[model samples]
Target: MRIIKNLLSACCLILVMNSCVKSINDDLSFVDAASAPDKLSVMFDITQDNTGLVTITPNGEGAVLYDVYYGDATTTPVSLTAGMKTTHVYAEGLYNVKVVGHAVNGKKTELIQKLTVSFRAPENLVVTWAIDAVNNFKVNLSATALYETAFKVFWGDVPNEPGQPFLEGQNVNHVYASVGAYTLRVVAYSGGAATTTYTTTVNIVDPVLIPITFESATVNYAFTNFGGATATKIPNPQINGINTSANVGRMVKNGPEVWAGALLTVGGNIDFSANKVFRMKVFSPRVGARVLLKVENLTNGGIFFEKEVTSTVANAWEDMAFDFRNINTGNTYSKVVIICDLGTTGDGSANFTWLFDDIRLTNQMPVGFLTLPVTFDMANVNYEVTDFGGTVSVPATDPTNGANNVKMTTKTGGAQTWAGSTIGAGFTSPIAFTATRTQMSIRVYSPAAGLRVRLKVEDRTNNARSVETEAMTQAANTWETLVFDFATPSNGTASMNLAWTYDMASVFFDFGNNGTGSVFYWDDVTFLTTNVIPNYLTLPLDFQSTTYPYPFVNFGGATATVVNNPNPSGINTSTKVGRIVKGAPEVWAGSFIDLVNPINFTVLRTFKVKVHSPRVGAKLLLKVENTTNPGQFFEKEVTTTVANAWEELTFDYSTIPFGFYSRVVLIFDLGTAGDGTANFTYYFDDISLN
Candidate 1:
């Protein structure tokens, strides 16, 4: 009875296990094969009078193989895998194409498509160029070909770019900013994929000089005529003992609208660093004629400056100066514009004619404040805010030790931790980073005290020479002069050279502060001239202060700085640490420290540096070189122990030959080129020897 009860319980457990268990082969096992091919598309790919090529594709489900039957020549059909394509030459007639998809279960579904192979290549393709009516620099394209549906034009300015297309025989226009040589290519395409190409070199000679003196009769300096005014060259007449030139420009204004003028352009960018004054020789038809002189960026006409000057001489030539000292020097100006008789219309008579010559820039200033020190006292002060999030910097007159000051208002963009305002000023010449003076001071007036203000100096041409320092505003709404010292080099950064570094000064107000609508005022931006402080040279070389002179002589495009230690280790419990980033493609991107006193290797033979690396077994090299002699150096390589962890790497100098080694070199991943990423950054601290 006991054995029978045990057998019944075992049978019940087996039944339950059979119902709950599943097999791995259940997903692969299927009952039915998939359906046939659908959504098939075909287009003729013909060139040179129908070579008889067609591109066909199909969208299908579960099709592994297809048999295509071309009902033209042969009885045997061609087989293709699902992604494979085939082209066949055919005669000029209708041919039927039958496509059959084969399933995994040997099931087949058939579909038929018709093709008419009638194609002709584009012939007699021609392209012409002309100037646009509205804008002179605009180039208009006219392409034509037989049996062509569209065209592609290659302007040849942008590299590795495909041509832009337009309908065949349709006029297309492209505008060029400056005058130069460009190879223009045009492709005339047939209704299919057949195309014919034509190329021509276009010499864009938009002749118009800044000082438009019509002395030569070679090329008609095509001055853009506007407002019913015709500008041309004429022989200067000795009318009333005035106008003493061989040839002069004449603007004959017709009896239409007022403000008739002629425009000219320069070949290159105008340098405005020296002076902003403009001078011109004008022979007006009458006195008090309002002559307007304007200069604009050749690329963007919107960025411009204009001034109206009244002529004092009537029917005679006199020199006039237009003060443009307030124009922004940083913006490029290459287009020169002029207008005579500003308010009234012209009648094509002698009273309407205006003659001008010798439009040039001069080194003269108006009666006002200069540009140095940037006191914001000048009426033409220039200031613009580069947004960390979004901001606007305006001139404020609520005096806090100045006639006018800069007011910064914050704006929110989405959600950002740090929203700040950066306004910069350009110097006429580069600010030299001298040995004695490498600091700049600024007076700030903030709403609240202790707001962080960062000041960055850089070469406007190259941002790589940029270096920055920050200071906290001490008082609210009170002028406090704060100095930012940049003399102390950190990490492995190359020293700032007076030869090429730091020309422009940019200031950020309330840096790293959260986004809010707070307003701040700043004024009295100046570069300080003070006595230099000597570097405290010691063996330990701790990165404790901003004034600590780093011994790196070369950085090789790598950025380095001192920050809080990411990984603290033995003998490096200090808060400050040195970080070096390999930010260039060169494998030799490294730093070499130049010690004030050479290391005596006979006394101390081993050196150690605490390094926190991204991975284990990374190659880190420490080398010592003679300060006077390069290429004569000793180097040692070591592999890191743990990943993302700090370890001490001891470089043995005992095996090295005896020499006065003052400069120390470091290279991470010495043989591999760094792609300038965050992963290439390395942190180190406590470089000491025993």
Candidate 2:
């Protein structure tokens, strides 16, 4: 009875297990059928010929080998070397190449790849020549043909015949006994039987002497002595008078002739159709003079036009130009003459002497037609705040509440605020503006005491990143005009930004502390651009004030100093130092100095140091290390002299392989002993790169 009960329980457990297996099979049946197949991967690299070799790898459990077809009807056995690459040279065409992978379990997979093949023709051939007058004349040939090919050259005095065949990429050097004319023919044959030929002419002539002259005949002036034909006249005389004794031209007695006949030209063929102008150089005169330049058409023998010019003492030896466009040439005459005179004897004293040189006929017009001075009027200063949609706020009343002329007001609190006004949200309120410049000027004004105003000037593009700012404090109510230089930022976008913030403590005005006070005004601003060259950095003697890390030691004769700072850090105070005497030691760590850009490294080709010590082992070391990763450094040692006088120590680091380094350290290591003074001192300046 017990065995029969156990058999009944086992049958019940088996039935439950079978029911669970059937439920799993039903759930798997819901999966997509397309996703249940084995995957085959095919990969290949494309070559210049447009065809590529492919490799196939199959991955599927419980699978067998079968036949494989590569989409082009080419079939092979499934057994292929693993990881082996094969080549397939297919004709030029686009194809959807596929590899069919099959298993003995009847399961199959296929991989498709889009393949393309292209065929290109050879490129054009090139020929170069090197003519040798003394020996053989060599002609170098090169071609862009991809395959092995033959070439032929036809050589003769006549260019239209075929000659002999030569191999491509060969240099043909032939000698000619005499100078004559020759023609060269080059032909190339490719693998496809396509051919191309090019021809050129070469001429060999005897060398001749070519004379180049630096003459000034292009201008209208011939020499004519004021004293007589025998008087020695300077080429361009500033003041002309008869020296009689020395035969030299001089400005004596009356004023000299500012317009000498030597500075005038006549009887020249002028072609107006080619667009020509008059150009001459003149020397400064002692007395100012008005000279008239008259142009006469020799064909018509009539004065066509005249131009009057005033010469001041400042008119030195500089080029003067006059255009013929506005001049009436009287129907484009073939011959023209120019005359210079003292303009009908008005204040014609002999103190005026003008020299002239370099007369040229040019087609260019004179530049700088007018010199207009830019001026600013402060009375018309106005501004408005407008949104992108062109909506403008009300004309902000001047002296609003207690503040005079709300130059700049902001609603945002904290950094952006206006005193005595209810602060609003968002960027808005009183805008600042500068008057347009007709001439350059500077405007200055004294503001209220304890009041600070921020002034900002930006370029025209409204690119605020380039805006320059200055803070002005009010000390008095006086107005002063300060000259402002506008040469550096000459892009002409110069606009103004004014903002004022007052502390809530006390209201201070001109001599009084009141709620309402007098307003501060500015006027007469001057703008000018000067051409002033800055002084180069020189070595200074105060070594302790330098920012560089130093234990700086001097062996008796050596001396050191700091210089000025330069833009781009060229030779400046921070860079230049002086060292005196021999055997003086100075060392700087590479980590403390700023490494210049990689491009600047090429400019700094060599390291130079000055040494006065006469020691044999005086040396300077320029060491550069990679800061990104430590332990990588390059050091160059320069040897110095032990002479009593100052001597330069140089190290040629032209071959130093430096790329993308972060740190550069320089050290001056003195030898253990030296002459003159064991304590040496040296002067060093211009730590320059290029």
Candidate number achieving the greatest TM-score relative to the actual structure: 1
lDDT of each: 0.68, 0.38
- lDDT minimum window of 10 residues, candidate 1: 363-372
Give the clashing residue pairs of candidate 1, or none: none
- TM-score to native of every candidate shown: 0.29, 0.21
- lDDT (10s digit) by residue, model 1, range 538-611: 34556774533464654666666778887665545678888878867678778776654455454478888888
Candidate 1 residues lying further than 4 Å off, grouped into runs, are 1-230, 233-337, 340-374, 378-441, 445-470, 474-521, 526-690
- Model 2, position 675, has a per-residue lDDT of 31
Q: Evaluate candidate 2 by giving its C-alpha RMSD to the native, one decimal.
A: 33.0
